[model samples]
Target: MKKILLACSAGMSTSLLVAKMKEAAEKRGTEVEIWAVAQDKAPSEMKKADVLLIGPQMRFMKKKFAVVAEEVGIPLDVIDPVAYGRIDGEAVLNKAIELIGE
Candidate 1:
């Protein structure tokens, strides 16, 4: 199973998106593990994830997030604002696959 870690300012906003992504994965028969957490807690969460996706508000921290992900050989990226706000699960899942070379 693939693991995706979502990070936001306080982990509140992305929590909703997490549910949508999960449903999308389920409906599409994609075996993925998704979770949302505050940006500050990302380091601990990263250990368990195969990829790290950040929300629009947290895009500025992409460099920092990338650094951590690289250290552990995990891919990292910022989610598309359009897909994120609209909760476009298919697009988000596609993006994750692209980022991770799936």
Candidate 2:
């Protein structure tokens, strides 16, 4: 199973998105482990993740995270603001899958 990690200013904000992503994964019969954490926890979390997606509000942190993500050998990107604001789970899930190439 692929592991997708999401980071926001605070972990709480992404909980809903994580749930939605899980629902989207279920609908597509995809097995994935998705979770969210505060920006400070991201580096440790990324060690076990296949991909790291930063919440739009935390987009500025992407460059900082890029180095760690590269060391961990995982794809990392900022969640699209439009999709994130809309809480479009499938779009996010698709993006994760595309990043993982699975």
Best-matching candidate per TM-score: 2
**For model 2, how many clashes?**
0
lDDT of 1 by residue, 1-102 (tens): 888899999998988788888888899898998899999999889989888999999899999888889888898889999999898877888888777787
Model 1 alpha-carbon drift over 4 Å, by segment: none
TM-score for candidate 2: 0.98
Off by over 4 Å in 2: none
Ten contiguous residues with the weakest lDDT in model 2: 80-89
Colliding pairs, model 2: none
Per-candidate clash tally = 0, 0
Evaluated at residue 94, the lDDT of candidate 2 is 94
* Candidate whose lDDT is highest: 2
TM-score of predicted structure 1: 0.94
Model 2 CA RMSD to the hidden true structure, in angstroms:
0.6
